[model samples]
Target chain A: MADKVLMKGNEAIAEAAILAGCRHYFGYPITPQTEIAAYMAKRMPKIGGTFLQAESEVAAINMVYGVAGAGYRVITSSSSPGISLKSEGLSYMAGSDLPAVVVNVQGGGPGLGGIQPSQSDYFQATKGGGHGDYKMIVLAPASVQEMADLTIEGFDLADKYRMTTMILADGTMGQMMEPVELKADAVKTYEKPWAVTGTKMARKHNIINSLSLVPEELEQLNFARYERYKQIEETEARWEEFMMEDAEYCIVAFGIAARVSKNAIVAARAKGIKVGLIRPITLWPFPKKVLCDAADKCKAFISVELSMGQMIEDVELATRCKKPVVLCNRAGGMIPTPEQVLAKIEEVAGGIN
Target chain B: MEPKRVSLFAGHYGSGKTNIAVNYAFLLKKMGKEVTVADLDIVNPYFRTKDSEKELSEAGIPLISSAFANSNVDLPALPQELYSLVERQDRYAVLDIGGDDRGALALGRYVPFILEENNYEMFFVVNFYRPLTTTAEEAMEVMHEIEDACKMRFTAIINNSNIGNDTTARDVLATFEETEKLSRLSGLPVRMTTVTAQVAEDMKDVENILPMVLQEKYFDINI
Candidate 1:
């Protein structure tokens, strides 16, 4: 076991990125997520890395695009509103197939909603917040440990697929502290053959841009990207099933909401109700197969979220309407209590058998 | 024997003071004392004693915090009811002070009343792993800074040296030597060395050890 240190989620993510050999960080300050930038600012200088507080999220994400195109590991983090400003740049990065890690420490939103934790950015994150029809490999971490682990994984996945990867966490997870063991120094694995490093006299020049004048060429590019997405969906869909073996009802949640639902499942189980939890660690791939498998055994499902039932749509789609799916949630920065979730589980279980 | 009535826990940021304070409150309450945890933290809005309102309340310990606590607002809205706790000589009170000199200034307002009314022990909690207080001299500097800001003196030093969740018995034992150095420099006795409860059972031979139940809201998903 490596040396474990108690770390806040945001700070842990930043340090993990550094440990993952991400030498360049560019980001704007936003609440609940400012710790990432602050940690980068303090440690990056000592470690001989570049940490720039960009003028805006737009400028910061564009800086990521530039660094990533040059074949360097780079990262940028923001809250909901700040992420909104970076969408265009994110789309540009995806269109150009540049590998970069973007962290969305989610907060309540439609506008500058609140600084408290919320899962309201589900649609914006997994469903392509940017303009193009591109999907980010969205990893939702429920703990401070996962915050560090997934950040390292996010960089690797980004480089593996040549696409932008996101660590979608909320304010609760960002502020919360837990013990985390950081990854030790390792050799770099993925090769960036398409990187726009300075063209030496021996090799052909590499062009990095999102522009293709011909519509046919752009259509072919989209099809190729979709093929990569298909591969990702097939292989990278990850989730955790708790007490799901003999469950009559299943609770679907992710991130902070999953933590609450786990408690609710325990409480429900104590009362002789066979409630289980399916926590999706990877939100983009949706973990549909596991949910479908649980749907076969469980008579009912409840989608517990910090948002107003955004992930429930995915749950319904995954189950194919085979079982009744209900929403047990708190929106606009409110978190559901274990008792509230337990009541929902009991209510759904009442209709099960 | 009667329990200690007024205990103040002060520390630097990320020093694990809040977790110690919460655990101490539970300890006192479990001993059948009338306990009240006053949230004197005006610096950090998140991870304060007020965030454990439900637990504290259910444990029969009243939590006295600012009105705007645990919210996005950063205003220091200290409640007038906190002064009444100072007047009550019957109950055991734990003052969970905020981080650093800036946070200690809030305690200055009640210094005269606390000094006049009751027997109090203001504990300066020190974590060796935290920045700025990595050494004994550096830890003494912070202790003096808090004393100057609060217009009161810390009676003793509490060695709360741990690197968050990664702390072990060895980590707690390693700080004992530095804390002795800190004791000599500050002319204050090392009251107790605190470690998480998980590590405490193995470190039984260590003197002046206070095992604290972890109160941090990591909220693990056991899946």
Candidate 2:
């Protein structure tokens, strides 16, 4: 009661990262998530951590690469356009198997998008982020609590898998304030034997590089990386189901859309629509099995999103198109209202016109 | 007649200052005062008095925020409309200054006018819920920084500590000692302690209580 303090989602992420033993932070300022860098700037120096506002997003991510290569927990954050600048470094980190965390507090995108909440970066985060056969462990947090919790989870997952874990939150999550209880004492540590820490005349020097020119070697590397990704897929897919026991229709959403969908689901239920929600906490290793199971029982599925039906494709694939998956969305920073989503739910339930 | 003509609310980031400022403006409006809420926030890129623009406009209160607010301009430029706050002495000005010194820097230019008027009550909205200003000393450190940046010492305190949307009357009551301690340390009076309307009914006896009309969050956002 006394210790739980109000924190913006961005501040929660920053404090959670520090609590999770992340000491080196490098980032360029971008809206909706700049509070993270600002917070890090204020707190990092006092705790003997390095907080560098790099010359560019590119330089910031490369600094992250350097720190992660040295076996230290490090992070960098940016919005949509800033993330586009870090893709090359992200691919390099993936190619080198360097474990670190990246955060994309997404805004409306396709160029210099509007500085408003949008989940348009779904495909960019979960699918085509960097130019390689790579996948970031993308965690979508709907509330400020999850924003903190998942940042800790992201660091642990990155270390465990030796890859990049991304906290994919919309502008609402980044900007909104909530009461968050941050656990500062309990930090999980990992053994990074392959880290490029100094050998000190004992062990062989670890070489951290991504440029493997050999055809067969590069092929094996890709295969091996995918193998690790497959393990992650089988074990790590996470989602939340609400009122799903006898639901006739299922709503699939994540981040802010998931929060909005909850309101719609409750309203639809009151109207005898029998709609439920499956909110994915993990976007990359998406909760496909839940969607598949919902497809069996549910008559229809609605994909609620802040983009032009990006997650709908995943829903269709996950459900094998067994039940009709309709897209209920708003693009370019506009989020769908609960009334709009409830209308879609009623539409799916049987013409409640 | 109870409060001064000019009311300034400034504090640490996420200290519930912006919400408090908006609610205070509405209070002045309810009192049949000519109210103008000037959002002098140049640091934080988050929620501002701009969130309540439509409601304020409908209520006939002129709202002013950063010139580039809610746009893709990405600059921390102040609006020229800020001068109206200083120029119009008849209107009751409720200011929502930015968080900490960086945000309060924008208030420096207007400090001369506020001091010249000598009828302003600058409030340091204290929130212990924020990470940086948990202790009274730490809170005072930030207050000093804000005082330095704005060039005007806060004349009063507004204990606005609360968890967004989850604040209980018990939580508001628990900070009584800290608020008193802050008031004692800074030699400033505790003007009011704010709580949401839901909790106000339960704790009506609490002194100097200002029941806030909170902006409903995104979940309960009015469509």
Candidate 3:
């Protein structure tokens, strides 16, 4: 009821970031996610915010690192190839324990693969694309509405955990338009005690650096980061379960794949198949327990993805390989249709029963 | 009767211009008129009329887009096929212009021919529900910017003010006064207010209703 308006997903994310009190935005223009920078460029000037179109993806991400260390909510957005360039900054942000929001409007890629929508960056995003044993919390959004909602949540989560929170979306989610509500004004939810705000004469200056020369000190940093990651793994995993109460088969998917799978699940149900969906909204602290628990009730698991077979690995691990896991996918920017998914569902049902 | 030989839809970003242009082309085709869709969207990298090329081709409506249109290739190469939109007066041409003034620059080349022909209806698509253009004055600023950029003034206003898929009959009706205010402010007639087929039945009493089927954002069926 708060004056919903139609918005492209990338634009929604940009506006939502501004509402969440993000005063600084640095990003290079990239396909699919171009609107985010354009919107920020147009609106930021009017609202006393900084919108810098960096010379390169590396430059933009480091700019984010600088602004985030200054204790301001900041964001940067890019596609796959651009994200690759930002990987070094991502690792540094993680090691420095800086809280920032990163938006990956994913495009097809192994190396500048295509401009079409793709989820092939699953391994790169969740498995730590940058060097070092660091992790960034990843959230995948299925709808344009989710694109905005999760961006606001991304900033909050980043602040709460003091880590990089990545909103991993594909081109479809970036380009698609849907009715979404944006906050005119958002309340900042957390205080940054460890922020590198210039210390007054009364307090000790906070240092924000990734490098610790001492090997044991660096080892301790890694240990402490992973301990926090463990706490996140236990408490922060998010997912959506559809028709899962009495499911015989479970379809694990996220983003656009999950949306397509919903229709397939409904169609399969009409054809007398008891199939359900487990859409992981959070990819890093993946819904592992749900998958492991559903394995006891479900006979088979199917991963419907926009990649060749990336998330299927996580599905196998999360479910503890309790049942046969199949990959139903189309790579290189192609999306699986409801019919194709329904046929695959039928095939799995036929094989199991 | 034939509405106009060449119809150009221009507006603020997210004003539902491309979707309306697509629907208008199909309407012309359904009216038993030969139609062509010219996509002049060079502003945004995605969400262009070229996405419906297959359906339009199947419907016998030729589509003219950039050479790199619909590809991951981000080249903003304007298509040479755009000349046909200005030359062919025997058939209907529906143009989906890119958003805002920067987008309207693509229209500058064909403006002289279109003005000389005088057989065109340049529509200023307005959606008061959009974030920036929520008021008549704000919407007018976009109108003037587009006109200045293209050197062709809009002939009428198309009220496409709806909140995407969640739009209801009341939402459409709520914008009636504002659309009317935009019309009075811009000195342009309110051509028609579009409502989706889902809520069109409830909006029967409304005047100048142009009921439309929303854009097929997803694939596997309708274009």
Best model number under TM-score: 2
Model 3 RMSD to the real structure? 2.3
lDDT of 1 by residue, B1-223 (tens): 2446889999775677888888888988888888899988876647788778888999998999998887766476789988877888888899999877878999999999889875888889998765457689888878888889999999888888877656778877777888899998889988888887888888998887888866645354434
The TM-score obtained for chain B of candidate 1 when compared with the true chain B: 0.94
Output per-candidate TM-scores for chain A, rounded to 2 decimals: 0.98, 0.98, 0.98
On lDDT, who's better, 1 or 3? 3
Worst 10 residues of 2 chain B by lDDT: B214-223
The order by descending DockQ is: 2, 3, 1
**TM-score, predicted candidate 2 vs. hidden true structure:** 0.96
Candidate 1 lDDT by residue in tens digits, A1-353 = 12566677888899889989998999998877877887788679989999999999999999999999999999999999999999999999999999999999888877888777899999898998899789999999998889988999898899999999999999988987766777755325587778888777868988899999999999999999999999999999999888988888999999999999888888899999998889999999889999988888889999999998899999999999899999999988789988899999888877667
Return the top candidate by DockQ: 2
Model 2 agreement with the true structure over B111-163: per-residue lDDT tens digits: 88889989989889988778888878889999999999888999998888787
Ten-residue segment with the worst summed lDDT in candidate 1 chain B? B214-223
TM-scores of chain B, in order:
0.94, 0.95, 0.94
Better of 1 and 2 by TM-score: 2
Q: What are the interface RMSDs of all the models?
A: 3.8, 3.7, 4.4
